[model samples]
Target: MSLLQSQVPGNLRLRSIDGTERLVGYSPPTRQNHGVAAVVGFEEQELLRDIKRALLRGVLIVGGGSLLALGMTLLVARRFIAAPTDALLQAARRWRAGDLAARAPGAARHSEFGQLAGAFNRMAVALQQREEELRHHAQLLEDRVADRTQALREANARLEAEILERRNTQTALLQAQKLQAVGQLAGGIAHDFNNVLQAVLGGVALIAKRAGDPAAVARLTGMVEEAAQRGQSITRRLLAFSRREELRADRLDVGALLVGLREVLAATLGAAIRVEVEAPPALPPVFADRGQLETVLVNLATNARDAMEKGGRLTLLAEPVTVAAGDPGGLATGDYIRVTVADTGAGMDAETLARAGEPFFTTKPVGRGTGLGLAMARSFAEGSGGRMTIASKPGCGTRITLWLPAMAVAAEPAAPVPAPRPGALPARCARVLLVDDEPVVREVLATQLADAGYKVTEAGDGAAALALLAGGLACDILVSDLAMEGIDGVTLIREARRARPALPAILVTGYAGDAAALAVGQRVEGSFTLLRKPVTGAQLADQVAALLGWRETV
Candidate 1:
């Protein structure tokens, strides 16, 4: 007890019985023992050894449990977090490389990682759906773009064609306007010029009959007749150009006409140009206006000559052709006499050829060409129930073709009987009334009728002639100029016929308009005879005698 209390108050260090150091603690005296102390002692080394062994055991158990728990956690993380994340990464990489079908694995697991993977898969599905929709829309857009592009191309082509057609129509309209202007000018000129020619022709005829020297009469009359004929030709051309000339359709011997035109063309084309005509002897006849045909041929020849400035060959050829229905040339389906005028000369280019038939469209220098040649030729051909076509190229020479309807059976033309001369008139005198606006024209015509053994009555105008007729002037025949100041010949004839329904009247006109007017006014058939002026004395006498039923006896 004394030893236990020797050092510390409650704790003591001693050598234990096993020869190890010990540590002890003592309690104070208890009441039950009346001063006895309670001691609690242990071997310090053994206690420390037990605590160390327990600590070692606890450490081993805890460490093993911790390792097991760590392994389980690692397994859970790999399956739930890392594995799903790796799968999503792989799927993402594939998706990034344009694989919209790629999806993450482990979506069936009920863990958070499974939920995360599910959401990622849903997002990927949505993205893929969106991508598919975008792809489909893109394809549709491409197709629509292609269709629109094609439509635009077609519309552009149609627009271009319409523009070209409109341009051609405008060109035709411009040509028509020019032709109208030219026609108006030609018509006015022809009216005045024809009156002058009528006076000259009538005066020449009178002078020729009165001349004493036969040789002088023949020579002077021949010159005057020739001059009058030239003037008449000029007027006819003017009327034809104005489209005012009445066409006289007749059966023509085309081959003979072509042969006759050879020398005339040679002289007209000059020595430099060579003209060749080729027409079969048995070529079919064409029913057309003879003067118009001749004029067209002359115009074509002139054009060919002009084209061959450096001297080239011109060929006029004729052949029979059969036109079919719906022909491109708009010709009637029938047998036709085809005439071609070809020239080996400077040819027209595409643009010039297109406008070849347009009025006032010329490639020639000013004053050298009227530009009406082709236009007039085309008009004549059409008017004659034919068609004209031009074929040419830049280097290749031109070929202008005319297709005239061929007569199936042509009758031989009757020989023109000579008009009875004034000396050969019947002894029975017929009363005549001649009316004219011009004093010179009236006096000359009155002299002609008097010389033909007819009692002549003259009036200065249609009104005077009507006044005379109304005053009961006995007239077996009435001849009047168509165009007059107050009452026109048509009106005078109409009034005169009312009084003498059996009276035969002759209407002479220089202007085509007056002839048309007379035609419109005359309703009765065979009521009148129309003579174109410059009527000869012999012609007037024959007509007067014919009206009176007086034929010259042999």
Candidate 2:
């Protein structure tokens, strides 16, 4: 290599020394001009430069050692910085990938970095705990919803059943109302009819009782008696519907009534079943509407008869009861006269028994029975302040008890009123007041009483009757219809009592039920009598004569 080439790549000028270091002239190499000649001087100075280089090497040794130490520190710092950061980055990546189980670096080479890693670990744990809490809460919410849904379903079913039952009950009540209306109408018309029949028979009886012509009297008497008997039958049926008769409200010795009815009861039930009556002697009498009581009896008897299709013994029993269980067929406990009718026959289950008192539930084939008998009997009993109960099992027999409330004391038997003395008919000379709403009924009653020889005064309304009485009209007997438009019979009765307290009064009405009859009967402190509708001349005379103390005759 030439002098310029022989130099180190970056060395431009050479330093020369002659036992002392010195700067020489710098040379720039020309393309081909300079050769090894220029380097001779530089070469000669190399030995001297070698000595200077050795001296410089000794001076730089300490700094070089320091620099080596600094380089080692920097290498360690880079490794530490990258290690924690890499770990934190890797942990974050796992957390972000939905891995809650990943744990962040908690221990670190440096204090500050260790805390940061710990914070990351804490945050990850908190997130995992929150997720678990959310899952558990959601499960509880689902369970609650399921429970509520089931409860709602049960409530809906119960409500539907109640609604259906209410509908059936409503239908039955309406039918009962209709049937009651029909019965009331029938009873109202029958009273007048009975009166007319009584008059016809009484006049015929008068003629037949005394005539000497046996053949003619016998023929006429036979016709009249037969007609009267038929009339009596019709009246009996009407009374059954109206719940009225010659009611003698005594301590009803129920045992006696049942015993007396034995023969007839057996025939009614037929030879298939044995009808039995068991009554403790000296059983207390029940204070009740006798006709209504009989209706209950007949209804229960018939029900027992129907229950024993294959021939079974039916027992009719009576016991003087002092007190009973609470809620006996929804009746409160009380002192009662218990009449029991039991049948050893095909029994009823709960479902059938529940519908027993419904107006029209019949197990018999259609037209074989009308279902009103039991309902009417129950209504009558209830109206008379009594109750009834039924007990039965699936295969066992049925027992029904009539619970009749007892009176404070057993009433003494009433003395029978004597019949009119022979040919001692009352002087029909009294002036009478007749008040009624129905014009035809008023005319009929007035004509009958007039034919019997009484001076009859007629008024179509209560106010007219009251006005006539207030005007000092001479009146011996006051006859008034119970129900009227302006002033009813009750108001008129009060006014009449105020007008003349000793005035003889009689009330005629279409309604003769225990409730209605009691309403009037309770007001009988004075001499007031009630004659049910459809009164005849003879009954009219009988009641009037009884009230006014006039002579009575056939």
Candidate 3:
């Protein structure tokens, strides 16, 4: 049993024929029921126990080492992952709160978490920069919009102002054109009419002188004088319209002017036109040229007569008026004399009314009417510190109002005025020299001087007069036509004065140019005077008598 036991590895169990547990040691059966139970060798039990203890101790040591390794791994994970994760969470929180600058800490920059943190910071910086740029762009757009809006508003205002100014300028231009046309027409009429008037007056004077019966002579003289006066009035109107008449501002009653104009219209406008004058007795007098005002009235009346081709009533009204500042006529604020001429005739339309005062803008067809009447009237009014207004409607006739500055006092009279009776010869017969380009004018004038009992010498031209004077023809007074084909009257007078330095000369002229020349001549160191053409015998005789210091023997 010992040798077998020695060969066996460790503790062993063996079962005999009897089914009983047994160790591999030699053991006797106890006397207890023939079933044997034996304690194995104590040493074997001890050895088995030792082997189990050693295996349990080694398992405990391995479990302790695994626990230590797990702890170390956890610590490393916390240091790298957990710490970065916490930082990232903080950055995310800050970013969500609109802090784009928030980023993971840079202390772990070498790790993946650090790399993620760096990327996040870069994105945040880019986003921040982009946001600022967008804000700046939005601000710029807002400012640009504001600037454009203001510029557009200013442009609109300027356009409106320019439009208004253009409209006013157009109106002024139209009115100016009308006045220019009228002045030309008037000047031409005056120039041509003067010649015809001269012939008529001379023929009438000759007829009156040759009358046989005393009653017949007086009647013929009266009729001829009336006609001559009417002709003179017409010429005055033409000159006034042309602005050729001198500015003779004087205080005059509008009523008297209207009365005289009524008679003129009666003769010229014919019986077809009915004229009415309605002026208050105590109307304020206007300071203006009397003849010009009369011309204004006559022109307006004639225009009215023309307007009413079918004959209509023309009313003239004069009244005192107050002109306030900002009045439509642009007159200074003060009291004014208002003269209105309302005509019952074909009225003007809106367009015509607006341009009524424009020169040469005649409503009538060519050759039928001249457009200058109203324009001249307005010009005269304006020249005299006043204005004109016209109110007209189609089919309703027209009303023209003239506002003239009121006069505070009547005009003072001259120191003294000499009165000479017409057709009176001088006390002393004076030798007179007459020169004219017209044969008929020279013939009638010489005849008139002869009737006045003055020896008269005749010359056809200025040269002839100069020749006569140079030839020692003595004369107290020299009368010459201002304009001639040869040497002009001014030159003849200048030449004649050398021979007769004390010569008293009278210049006869139908042209305004001649009048101007005569004015220049009068300024020279000699006695010189001017006479308008269509000279009546009486005017010629009176002028001659005055120059010679002749007086009528009472």
lDDT of each: 0.78, 0.72, 0.76
lDDT of 1 by residue, 22-118 (tens): 8987766655557666788888887798789999999999999999999999998886678777888898899899887887788898977678778
How many collisions between residues are there in candidate 2?
4
> Once model 3 is optimally superposed onto the true structure by TM-score, how far is the C-alpha of residue 239 displaced, in angstroms?
3.1
Instruction: Give me the runs in candidate 3 sitting further than 4 Å from their true place.
Output: 1-211, 247-253, 256-272, 280-285, 289-310, 321-335, 345-383, 387-397, 411-414, 417-427, 517-523, 550-554
Best by TM-score: 3
For candidate 2, list the clashing residue pairs, or say none. 191-534, 192-534, 195-536, 251-285
Q: How do the residues 1-554 of candidate 2 rate in per-residue lDDT, one tens digit apiece?
A: 33455433223344444454443433446545453233223454655778999889977997899899999988887777677788889999999998888876745535777888888988999999998999999999999999999999999999999989866765666566447445534553455456547766775877667698778777777666566554554555456535555564556767777885554456556678798999989776677766667766766776777788888998988887766576646565777778888999788888888987787776655334446656876786676567777789876888887778766664679998776565653446777899999999999899988888789999999889888888989887889888789998777887887867777788888664533544554654465777776567789976776655543321
Candidate scoring better on lDDT of 1 and 3: 1
Give lDDT: candidate 2, residue 290. Answer: 68
lDDT by residue for model 3 (14-103), tens? 665665555564444444526454445334454478899999999999999999999999999999789889988898899889888776
Candidate 3 lDDT at 347 equals 96
Query: What is residue 363's positional error in candidate 3, in angstroms?
Result: 9.6
Candidate 2 off by > 4 Å = 1-135, 143-151, 154-251, 255-283, 287-299, 308-429, 436-455, 459-472, 484-504, 513-529, 533-554
Residue 362 CA displacement from its true place in model 1, Å: 8.9
> Each model's RMSD to truth, in Å?
30.1, 26.5, 31.7
